[model samples]
Target: MRVQLKHPARLALALAFGFITASAAAAQEPTPEPQPAPAPAPEPAPAPEEPAPQDPAPEKCEVVIDAAGVPINAEPVTVKASFSRDIGQPARAQVASESGVRVLSAEPDAETPLTFTLTLDTSAGNAGDWAIALEGEGGACEGTISVLPASAPPSR
Candidate 1:
């Protein structure tokens, strides 16, 4: 035997069916994800720093004066400067008086790689200790001169 619902039972069944339909529709729709707080707008980065300028490299060469002959007023003396190593080619020499000594002339050795001689002298008024410097092909040498006054006795 089939049992049919009366008026109150039919109304209760309709209310239950409507509630289930609403729940199913709500579940089918996409739920909005909790939006992450907009990443606080990024602060501007600082500009990159410029590097400092560098200094020029210093000159480097190891050379020496072989002999700076004794100095006598009004008398020319020969001074020789020799480089520690062969420069692989002929070199031009530049001579300058470091002190008050006079450099009469400079000449490079014909057969040597880096060797030269200087003719140096001091006038009677310039007699005393003086300094001379020679530069050639990236090398430099300095020497002292002990000039004797005209009145001084000759050295043995």
Candidate 2:
């Protein structure tokens, strides 16, 4: 079973047969299985944003002191103190004197004039005037109250 390619026609046929066999072998050879395209690199996460700045609130203001006067009474009597403007909420009342008179209680109303009905006890206080002050969350006002001797009883 020996074949010779000495003639021109036999040489051409041999070359064509060799080329076809090479092609067939190449086609049958297992090509590297296409690797799944590497999953695209995961995209980077986005950054968080900062909040906008805000303005600060205004400060508490002082109110006007229109009038501060006590009408009457010194023996556990309530007195009213009127203001000209808003004074927030009346927190408390303070009283001072050169004698024994003092304030028993203080109550604030939520209406105009900013009235403070203060109970003043003058039983153990001397007959004189005392300083009365009203303090609130926003402002303060001060005035004076007089304590005097009661009138004597007439003869029966």
Candidate 3:
């Protein structure tokens, strides 16, 4: 068959090819998608566990001591102190004298209630009106000690 290239027909063919090429290009390109909103942040988890109970506070205890009125002249004086359940630990007792005497030793009761034998240094002149003190695990107890002078001979 004999072919004829007319101006209108050529223009029409070109336009058709352009449309096809544009459509093919568009089909090959990827389409943009609408992004989903970010998921709401999860609420913080509840606290791990409950705390344990605490022990009750200790009660005030009564402390007492007794000794002979007779004075014994010695380098290391011996005075006895007694403690009961009313009193706490035996280690807290502190013995002192008004004369600023040194405490050589404090012997705690091994059995039964807590008793202490406070040894003092006579060199410090720690005799007459000495003050004995007791202390608990807490602070010092009220009116701890009283070291009276040795018993004197009756006057004629």
Reference-based TM-score of each model: 0.40, 0.45, 0.40
In the range 1-156, model 3's lDDT, one tens digit per residue, is 977667888979999999999999999999999999999999999999977768765554444556543143445667666654434543444445455556577666666456656676654354454455666554444334444444576899
User: Least lDDT summed over 10 consecutive residues: which range in candidate 1?
Assistant: 87-96
lDDT of 3 at 12: 94
- Candidate with best TM-score: 2
Candidate 1 has an lDDT of 0.60
The list of candidate 1 runs beyond 4 A from truth reads 1-59, 85-99, 125-130, 136-156
Per-residue CA lDDT of model 2 for 1-156, tens digit only, reads 897667899889888999999999999999998888788888889888867768655443332223343333444766566655556676776667564666677676546456666677766666656666667787766666665655566879
Q: In model 1, state the lDDT of residue 67.
A: 46
- The residue-level lDDT of candidate 3 at 146 comes to 46
What is the lDDT ranking, best to worst? 2, 1, 3
Candidate 1: the clashing residue pairs are none
34: Cα error in model 3, Å: 90
- 2 versus 3: better lDDT goes to: 2
What is each predicted model's overall lDDT from 0 to 1? 0.60, 0.63, 0.59
Cα lDDT for residue 144, model 2? 62
